[model samples]
Target: MATATRRSATRTGRTTGRRRRWTAALGAVALLAGTAALAGPAHAMAAASAPVDFATHCVPPPIAGIPPIDGTTTAQITVDNAAPKVGDTVTVTYTVTKPAASNPVDLALPADIMTPTGKVALGGAQTGSVTVTGPKKNPPVPGKGSFPPFSMTGTFKVTAPGSITLAPGDYNIHTSYIMELDTPCTVITPPAPVSETVVATDVPGANERSIQLTTASGKPGDPVTVTGAKFAPLADITVAGRAGAAQTADRTTVKADAAGGFSAQLTVNDKATTGIVAYEGAAWSAEKGAGPAAYTVIDDTPAPPNSQKLNSSVKAGTLSMSQAGDTVALSAVDFGAGGASTGDLNTVTVKDFRGGPAGWSLTGKVTDFTGPGGKIDAGRLGWTPACTTKAGSPSTCVAGSAGVVGSAGATLASTPNGAVTGGEFTVGAKVTLNVPAYTAPGAYSGVLTLTLT
Candidate 1:
């Protein structure tokens, strides 16, 4: 008795859909009811044995199509083989079915092939010349006939440390009995196929990149900001030659006051002082793919000192003289009212230094004199003196000394001087001059500029 069933064929289906219909009645009868003679001393005998049908199937996993990732797929394949490395080895299961006439059996395998540059290099050949075999008993299903599995196996090894030029591929190869599993036969035979590919990371290609930052004038201690305009987000930054935190970035926004941009504050470190400075971006091929950018550093230092460099100033002015032959005559010297005249000699006396010179004193002999004398105060007077042909002249001042060679010097009788005027601060005392009968004549002058400072 043959049971009838329909075979469904759907191509391009990655998953399988199975349909089973059970028989409610086998046309069997109760031997007890129909029998007296049928059961005379009932002994049992074995019914016709239905051979087990091993199904044949072949399928492949989907290949990665995403361009950004460029990935591939892997699949697991099993077979009913007489010499299987794994799986049930006890019973040699077999399958029998008619091979489809249309769509000549297609042996699908992985497209991933390993080359010297390929992803895998196991040491075996680049292209596999593998053969798949099935069991010897290739019979039809139950209603058709009984048969054992068609088992055959091909063994190959993948050996490579780094991939010899190219690596050998890995696969779960199986013997295929390409037949319609949709058949109504008691055993469905599927197309057995082996598949595998080199699944490994190729030695990553070497990579690199850089970024640059600059100031209008690359001067030390100048405030300059380096923005990673060319770099994408998540780029590392270094500050003042000091390595910074990972990928310190800035935010982007369209708001009016939005602070959109990544910035690296560089204080211009001494180490980074190259007369030129730059902030750079480099190989950040992490997430996806991209190139690198570099920057140069500039140094600027020779600028003149600021106008506010020194904020204070000082000026000096005074009036003084030394003793001549025998008389002393005082003329305008450092006229600035900056200091005082004091000692066992005399206290500082402010006097008029305008319209004439200061007065001097007499020493050894009377000397010729000129210029009108005016009372600087009650004590000091303004006057000028000159040397005369004769000593002991009534109009001349005389000098007094120790009678020694140079000791017979002029003693200033009156040397014109004055107190501080126009915000002048006094310092030391004044020198005295003496008119001498033989004193030399010469115009001595000195500037006395006083300052509020």
Candidate 2:
């Protein structure tokens, strides 16, 4: 007897011809099952007439000498979205190569269309059209080969229904050959069952927003532009200033174009303050909003003219000292007596009027000193002075010894323009006399001139 066995082994082979062998095999099985009743004993008829035992198998176990079909078929599954969110229509696509004809390709997904972890549940899967992608001239019908080495794609859509979130997991596509299990066809070998897994990454809901303005600052009545890239399509944008009041513009409302890009210029109001103004915006149809861009409005009024005024209240009556170190402190009144007074001292009040210059140079020059009898040395009389910008403020002293002013006259003090305030300043002085003990005692006087610039 010659024993024939079917088996599977990787082998390179080509298709020989097309035939209808599967139908004949079915008919032969039907004949055998029917004749069993007549040939068997009456008591065993029902059992004997049972259908012939032909276990369904695909690419059967390898025979002793025969080789398995060659030229492997490869398929890859892709999705429009790597991570699908809830309520998103996820597209699952299959690109297949070297597909066989006369066999139907079956794609099997999880029965419930839910994630393996049971976190996400889709509405259901819907199969879309299958498209042939090869042969520029005329594409072959997918799985009905008229061309060799061709590629085709099948697509399906899954809707992530309402709020059931799909957690992170692998969603697999199971594929197999339906008809090629029993009936073999040339140019078609049932590819071994394979699975392709797609990873889930996001839970569907609200998306984050990013929006901004080109420039933050502008003067009153000037144009400031605003832009947003993530707003809803064709949505209207409303802009406002610090008070949340809608900004006045040539166009108060601007709409975002189809791609969610928006741009519009708004003018700062004339009544705006000289300080900073913050701007913000919102899309009419959006759940979120954007920005507080700071803008500054400046005042542009000119200032007034300045003037400088000087007054002095010195108790300049007489000078008398008992010893070389003896000092006579003169009482001096400032802009007013109660206002400011270096008691028993001399003080000059300096004021800068609206039209006056900012600063001045003061120099004290003394001529030859004279007494009731004859002349005395001018260097014998010296003074120390200090200045104060405000009436009640403390005074800052000039760098000098207590008795240093001489016949030639020295720079007592020099002040910068800003050291004075409220258009006024005050200068206080303390005078000291250095007299030889043996010198004749008599009334003495000297002319002191003050030059102000």
Candidate 3:
């Protein structure tokens, strides 16, 4: 009886083991079916795991004339703040009406983050859209689980890009909705774009230095005022120009005020000619910038050789044989002018109206002589220099006056010629004829000339 019972138990165990193995295989098949239902098509599921194929996923149809979706669903988007400052946080809210019954919908917020020029992904852009899918349900009841009359809020932060600068202007944010997953039935709505203004505050230490002049024109030895701003604080400023008199200082130094402002006076160089000059000022240190002030330096010195004249008394004198070895007054030459005087006999005024203070002298001679009374001997004429006097009278005889006069017709008394001082000089002359006891004598005439050099 024990042996028979044992055989019967073994047969039952064998049958039960086979049944358990079959049940476990059925469960594996069910699990695979559930996974397939949860995921979409095989191709779409694979594509999601790889780098997005922008050609199909990102590209959208032309917005022109596309009919609006005829569903009960409606969407609204709102940003926490329309005008956001750089480096601030932004909150975007998306609200939707009841979604369609057949298709699962995806709410998308594509913050294009465009610039004024409508370029994307630039100018401090914290871009790319955020997608919120329908809520997960155990056995997703056809359209009941995550479909609309729903409100979804998403938050993103905007920060000034380290590589790009965010200009202060309007930046656009766009909103969209994906109606169906990986199907032609998907409807994307482009809502009215929202704009946010980016603003910046003032930064310190960005001021540049500049300078200006009080007047536009000046002359040598003339004073000029210079004003400057935006220089280094408490800096030593040096002003230089070409508008001062000869042997006069033209450069000056002054310390800038606490606010980096300064005003100073400088003279143009005395010898500066008539033209333009770049009057400049700068600080000793390079931290303080340089400023240039344009100035016109004019020549005020007048043209030379104001006035001159020649006078002679020999033209009115009488030549007679009775005056032998006796000296007579020939002529008195005088010079005085109303112009710049060097207070010395340093001028030899010329007929060309040019004069210099090089000290002048007078020379007398008989250039030529001929008349109805016949010509006198050329060797018989001589002259004596008179001392220069304010009263026009001889006070002292000029040096070399004696023995310096000679009978040379070309140049008479040149060696002993009188020196011109203070623009005035004069000379007296005498005539002597070698009258022999038997020589026939008649009236004779001759000419005398005086030159100033």
Candidate 4:
């Protein structure tokens, strides 16, 4: 009998990348059609044994989707031989298809044989385009493994028929192989592909900080001013607002010498009754915010003085007078008194017009008066009377500019307002009136003055 071969295995397949000569192995023919003799004295003897069937399987399914992106081709192998006896060695062989074939799928094993019934069987994996190497004498028949070529077909055969002696139980064989792309694949780059990013741009600001106007509210015959700050010189002014009129520089304008601001004027009647004045369109350069922001033609014409406050002191001997009127109107009229400063006792003739003695006497501690700094000044207006008496001091009542009744021609007094007269009461001014000999007492009156200061 042939002693079991000490070492043996053979695998072969066609390789597309490598031009190696193809090797072929005859796969084990299927089980013998007729049954072999049952194991008895002869059957269980070293010569009595049944041929084993060969099977193939795979792990990490080759066709499955994963890292490979494409499936792999590979396979595991198993063998079955029953009734083997000791003292017999075996050889196994397998064949795998060429990688070039789209479905080149196969694997093979060689130097295979059944082991003695009481001996441990051999098992393992066989993979690669070429035959895989395994334990020297097929160690134990059934074994497991990991392989890559995921999708390939395989078939195998067991040579060394005389190597195995005998066996009682059915002996099995096993081996594994991998599946990988026989034909390499590559990706082609896309032609003319485009990528883009957007960047934003910012816009700068313009001129024009603010705009305001004085007396923007007025009737058609009344006044309206288109005013604001940072207004350029000779700028065009319009009032399409209430009365709606566009006035050019020379015609409807006011300019500054070194001052950068100016004023514009317009008038409106019932046509300008609307409370709103969508007045903008004022242009400027190098100003804050946007240019010419719209402005409401507000009734800047100060509400008629809510109440006029008069500031001054009166002496029984010193007479004085003052007047207050529409400042805007006053500024325009500038009615200086009759040669005398405004509120500067124009015609100091006492009269019932306000208060005086029985009839009215123009003669008092003072007759005519004047002032500086828009203040009323009087020298000849006061009289050193012969009466003396001081409710607050030593008893003495002097006849101060005695209260007297004069003829109608003597009681007349008149001093127009809006005149650059009197002392310089720059900011705010006051006017005063007195009746030397106020007949029936309580002297009161509403006096309007249009003075120029």
Scored by TM-score, the top model is 2
| lDDT tens readout by residue for model 1, 1-453 | 101121111111121111011111000010000100110010111111122222333222222121121112221222111111111111111122222111112433211110000011112222222221121122223321212222222212221112111111221112122211211111122212222222112223311111223322223455445443323344343332321112222212111112222455555444232211122233222221111111112222333556321112112222222211211123322233312221111112222111111122222211122222211121121122222212221122222232211122233233221111111111212333322222222222111111000
Query: Which is better, 1 or 2, measured by TM-score?
Result: 2
Question: All candidates' lDDT scores?
Answer: 0.21, 0.30, 0.29, 0.21
TM-score of each: 0.13, 0.23, 0.21, 0.15
TM-score of 1: 0.13
Which tens-of-lDDT digit does each residue in 1-453 have in candidate 3?
A: 001112111111121100010000000001000000111121121111111111111212233223323333334343332333333233333343333322222322222110000111113333323221111111222321332243333222233322222111111111122211221112233212322222222223422454545543444677867666666677777765422111124577778889988888877764442111122244222133332232444334444577422211101111010111211222211223111111111111112111110122333344222223344344543333333323431122242253222235222112111111122233333333322232222222233333332
For model 2, the run of ten residues with the poorest summed lDDT: 20-29
Clash count (model 2, backbone only): 20
Model 2 score (lDDT)? 0.30
Query: Candidate 3: lDDT over CA atoms?
Result: 0.29
- Highest lDDT: which candidate? 2
lDDT of 2 by residue, 1-453 (tens): 000121111212221111000000000001000000011111121111111111112232122123433333334433333323322223223333333222222233212111000001112121112111111112222442222222222111222222211111111111112211221212232222222322233444543232333333333577756555555677666654432223323234577789866777666564342111211244222234433232333222223347422212111111011111112222322221211111223345544331110223344545444443355466655667666565442223233334555667655444432212123455545554444444333333344433332
Global local distance difference test of model 4: 0.21
